[model samples]
Target: MTTNEPRPAMTMRQIREGLGHIEPGQPDPIVQTTGYTVSCLPEDHDERWTYTVRVSYRGDGLWSVQCRSQYVDADGKRSPGFCWSRGPQEPATQAEMDDFDAEQAEWLKAYRFDHVTALRIAKQLAPTLTYRGRTVADALAEPVA
Candidate 1:
């Protein structure tokens, strides 16, 4: 398909289906859906999936956003990528939390990126925000332990 082709925006159901696989050390029983970003892996191999989302507690408490990434191999094995803070920088005040929540809702409502956008975010965030798949050449160059 041409790069310019418009793909349908991912539905809430689809997004929910691909999210927050509890990697050890990740908070559980309460990953807030919020919004997410995604990307496909390197070209020569079977397609792998990479996704990132902001999560927080569902109940009353301090509100903060933790950036979490999920990596799914071509065969669908789940692996942890990395996690970091997104906004409010933690120890958020009630006012900050309210503002962040409002801004986030607006941002999510206005933009739902397609594969192209996801790919861009993935490429840019690689080595920092998300897991990267090894390329064919790299695999061959390294000795298998």
Candidate 2:
């Protein structure tokens, strides 16, 4: 019978029954999207100045890591800021996955202990800020201390 009516959605019980039992500690068949950010103050900057390390999945077996600098003035005015993204990388091997984590950690460490160098590296990676006519990279390039 070909009817124009929409099919009813399957209930949870019916779906689970079709899939059978699942073992404990087993990875889920469905892919999960995950992300996190680590914020830290620059070695030489005051409380208003800080940076963040971001790691996120960009779908289709790809991941990305980014670092960004932020600032807020005493009047509570915020700057557009500048940022750099590393990759939408596809790690085909376990070693490559490990390298990804290591690289992100290294950048985090740089921001914590060597803010100037980290900003320099980020500037090199992303030369222009994609905001309004004003580019925050110039502000970031100026001496912090």
Tell me the TM-score of each prediction against the true structure: 0.22, 0.23
* Residue-level error in angstroms, candidate 2, position 68: 1.1
Q: After superposition, how far is residue 108 of candidate 1 from its true place, in Å?
A: 1.5
What would the per-residue lDDT of candidate 1 be over residues 50-88, giving only the tens digit for each residue?
A: 233332332343122223433332222333432223532
True-structure RMSD for candidate 2: 16.2
Model 2 stretches astray by more than 4 angstroms: 1-12, 15-32, 40-49, 69-145
Clashes of 1: 0
Clashing pairs in 1: none
What are the per-residue Cα lDDT tens digits for candidate 2 across 1-145? Answer: 7999999998665666568755444555775646544333343543212344444543444334454433222222333332224354334455654665555544433332133333343434333333335344544555666
For every model shown, the clashing-pair count is 0, 0
Best by TM-score: 2
Candidate 2 CA-lDDT value = 0.42
Task: Give candidate 2's error at residue 8 in angstroms.
Answer: 24
